[model samples]
Target: MSEHTRIDCDIHNEVPDLEALYPYLPDHWLAYCRESAFNGPDAADYPESVPTTARDGSSPKPDLAEVQARVLDDVEIGILNCAYRVQSVRNEDLAASLATAVNQWQVEHWLEKETRLRASIVVPSHSPPLAAREIDRWGDHPGFVQVILPVRAEAPYGNRRYDPIYEAAIRHDLALGINYGGAPGHPPTPTGWPSYFIEDYAGMAQIFQSQVISLVCEGAFERFPSLRVALIEGGFTWLPSLMWRIDKEWKGLRHNTPYVRRRPSEYMRTHLRFTIQPLDAPPNPLHLAQILEQCGAEDLLLYASDYPHSHDSQDFLLDLLTADQREKIDSANARTFYRL
Candidate 1:
C-alpha cells in the first residue's frame, strides 16, 4: 500500500463546561444558565483537581497550535482527530444544546484555525434525534471526520434509538466515534456507582466490550455496513479475548442473533478501529510484538497520544512492529477507518 502520512487518531481538546458554553446556548437556556446554580464537575476532559486525571508527566501546551507542534510539526503527523467531550450534564435538552455548541466551538476555535486538525461531531447520546441533527448539521464539514458519543450511555449504543445516528453516519460517511465520558442516567458500573476513581478508570475496557457486543448482537453492523466505530481512549489488549469469546458464543447462539449472519469477530474486525492510548502492554517488552500478533491488532490499533491526559512516551507500541505494520497502523488503517 502507498503510505504518505501518519495520523493521531485521538486527541482531547476540553470545552471546560457549562460556563464556557453559556455564550453558545439559546437565549432561553442562557437565561436559565445565568439564574440556575450550575455547580458541575469538569466532565469535558477530566477535572483538573482529580490528581489521577490531572495531566502530569507531559508539559501541556496552552492552545491547539502548540499541541500540534509536538505531535505534528515535530513528530510529523499528517492529521489529528480532535474529540471535545461535554455530555455530562443531566438535563437532555441542556446536554443537546451543549453538544451543538461544542461542535461549533471546536470548528470555529480549533478546526478552522488548524490546518492539520479534524474533529469528531460531539452529540447528545441522551437524545438521539438531537444528536442526529448535530451530525447532520456538521458531519459534512471537512474539518469533522466522525460523530462522537459517550460510551457510557443509558442503554447500549446498538439500541434502535441509535439507528437514526447510524443512518446519519452512513448518509454522511461519518464514523461513530465512541469516547468514554459522562452518561448521566447510567452509572459506569453494572451495580450502582463505584466509590473510587481507580475503579472507574480501570473499568473502561469492560464498558466498551458491552458496547461492542451490543452493536454486533443488535445487528448494527448488518444494518449499516458502511458505518465504522472508533473505540477512542479504550485499551486494545482486551480484543483477542473478547473476540474469541464472542465468536464462540455466537456459534451456539446463532439462532438468537441470526441477523449477525457471521462470526461476531468478523464484523468487529471489519468495522471497528481503536486508539492506542491506554493500551495494556505486556511488561516483557519483547512480548509487545507477540501480543500484537496474537490479537491481530496490526490493522485495528490506531496511533494516538490521547494527548495531555495519557503518557506512554516510551511504550508507543509502534517500535515493536515491523516497518510495514507500523506504516499501516500509523496512517493507512485510520484512512480506511475514517475515510480521511
Candidate 2:
C-alpha cells in the first residue's frame, strides 16, 4: 500500500427509512411492516437533536456521491458500519428479517457500487442463532469484512449463548465489530437510567470496559483463538487503567477462570483492535501520549473518521505519535486486521 493511502475502519451508511429497505426485505416482512404500520426501529443512540449526529453542513443521509465528495476523497478505503438499530427490535423474527434486509441493502446500494468501500454484516444480535445464521448467509461476500453487533446486549457478548456468533465469525475469517449503540431495554449505565443524554453518552466507555472484561474473563478469546474484535466509537483514553486493573485482579482470581490461561491484558492486546474516533483525548497532549504508552497500543489502534458524527479535534493525539506509529494507526493496522 502507498504511504499516502488511508483506511477508515468505521463509517456510517444509515438506512434512510423503512421504505428504502422494502426491496430487500422478504414479502412476509414487507406485509408485517405494512399491516403493523411500523415505520422503522428507533436505532440512533445519538438523537437527531444532538449535534454529534452529523457534522456541520453535511447531509444526514449522504448518498454515494456525497460520501465520495466528502470522506472518500480523502481516504483510500472506508468500511461501512450501518447503525440501523436492528438489535433494538424486541421481535426476534422481525429483527432477523430486518438484519437480512439491511445486509442486502448494503450489498446492492453501497458495496456493489464502490470498490473503495467495504461493509460490516449487520445481525439480529439479540438472537444468537439468528445472528449466526446471518453471518453464515453473507459471510463469504468479498465486500463484507466484519460482523457488527451492538455494544449493549441482554447479556455480555462473551456469554456462552453468543458462542455461535463467535464460531460463525471465525469460520468466515471475519472480525467481530462491537460498535456503540443499541437499545437492549436496559439502562445504559450500571445504575438506573440517566436523566440527561450527556450522562448516557459519558457512560459509554464504562459499558465498553465491562464488555472487554466479560470477553476476557469468560475465555472467549481462549476458546476461539482466531476471533478478532474491534471496539468502534467507544473512546480509548480509559484503556490503560482498565488493562492494569484487569491484569492485577486476574492474578488473584485466576483460579476462578482456569480457561483464561494468560493475563487478561495480554489477550486484549493480542485479539482486540480499537477504532480511534471519539478519541477522548485530554486537553494536554502529553497526557494522551502517556496513555498510549501505558497501554502499548501502537498496533492496536485503527484510523476512523466516524463520519457524520462530530468529535473533538484529533490533531493533538496524532501529533503525539511518531511517524511509523501514525502510519499504522492511519491505515496499516486496519489493513492487517481486516485482511484487506
Candidate 3:
C-alpha cells in the first residue's frame, strides 16, 4: 500500500475484549455488570456468550486484522482509530475507575498493536472530581488524544457542574468530544416514544446543536479560553443555522447571558472544530462550501469515515472530496485541527 497524506480524525474502532480490562473497574460496578448486560438482554441471559465488542454487523468479535487491512492497506488511511471510550462508559457511578480501565485497555491493546491509532479517555460526566482526576491521570499518555463524553447528560454542558472537566481539558490541552447518546432526558416529544432507531437517530443533530448553543451562549468558551471542542458524527451541518439563530436571539437575550462577551458565531469559529462523516446523502458541494465559508472554519473541518457504518468509509469519502478541495478535506484539515 502506498503512504497517504490523509489523517482520518474519526473512526469507530470497537473493543472485542473489554471484559479482560474489567479487573480495573470497581467491584460494585463489576457486580452490576454481572446482573445486567450493557449491550442487551440476550447477552444478559448468557454472559459467556456475550462478545466484548461488536463491529458493524459482522461477527460478535470482529477480526481486527480485517479492519486494519481494509482501512490501512487498501484505503491508505494513515491514522484510523477511535476518539472516544469504546466500552465501560455507560455506568452511572461517575467513577474514574471505568475511565482508567478503558484508557489502559486502549494502550495495552490497540495502540500497542498499531502505530497509526489513537484513542480518547472516557470520564464519568456526573462526577467532576473523578473526571478531573482521570484527565490528570491519562491525558499525558501518547496513545490518548481527547476527553470524550456523551451529549445526553442531563445538565447542559455549559452548566457549572462541568466546569472541572472543562478546566482539566484546558490544563491538559486535550480536546473535548461530544458524541450522541440517547434522549434529552427531559420531556416527551409530541409523538410520545420513538418507534424506531431511525426516529431517535434522526434527532441527534438537533440535540448536538442545542448543546453547542447552550455551551456557547452560556459562556463556556469564554470561561475556558484554551479549551477545544469537536462535535462527532456528521451532525456539524447543523452548526451554521444554529449559530445564526443564536446570534439573532442574543440581541433580545443578551442580558440572560451577561458573561458571554462575544456572539455565538465568534466563539464557535475560535474554539470549535467538527468532523465530517456519514455525510448527508445527495451531496451538495456548493451548500457544504457555503457552510464552511459562513462559519470561517474551513481549516478546522476534519475528515472522518465513521468506518464500518456503511455510509462512511474510505472509498465513500474519497469520492466525496471535490477535485479542488480534496487535499484540505482529506488531510490538511485534520492535521491542523488535531496538531498531528
Per-residue accuracy of model 1 over 1-340 as CA lDDT, tens digit each: 2244678777677664557666677998788777887643335335455553435644432367657655565333433344444456667787777777777778787878887788888787667887888889987788888887777777898888888888988889888888866545557888888887778878877999999999999999888888799998878878888888999999889899779898999998898988888777777767777667766888898877676665455255866777888878878788888777
User: Which structure among the candidates has the greatest lDDT?
Assistant: 2
State, as a TM-score between 0 and 1, how close model 3 is to the true structure: 0.81
Q: What is the C-alpha RMSD of each candidate to the true structure, in Å?
A: 2.8, 1.4, 4.8
lDDT per residue for candidate 3 within 269-302, as digits (tens), equals 8878777764553366567666656665455567
Least well predicted 10-residue stretch by lDDT in candidate 2:
40-49
lDDT of 2 by residue, 1-340 (tens): 2357799998889888899999988899999899999988876586765888889977667778878888897698999998888888999999999999999999999999999999999999889999999999999999999999889889998899999999999999999999887888988887888898788778888889999999999999989999999999998889889998999999898999999999899999999999998989888878888899888889999999898888886677777878899899998999999999
> What is the full ranking by lDDT, best candidate first?
2, 1, 3
- Give candidate 2 misplaced runs (Cα > 4 Å): 1-3
What is the lDDT for 299 in model 2?
Answer: 90
Using TM-score as the yardstick, the better of models 1 and 3 is 1
**Lowest summed-lDDT stretch of 10 residues in model 3?**
40-49
**Where in model 1 is the C-alpha error above 4 Å?**
1-5, 39-45, 51-62, 75-86, 314-316
By TM-score, the best candidate is: 2
Query: All candidates' lDDT scores?
Result: 0.75, 0.89, 0.63
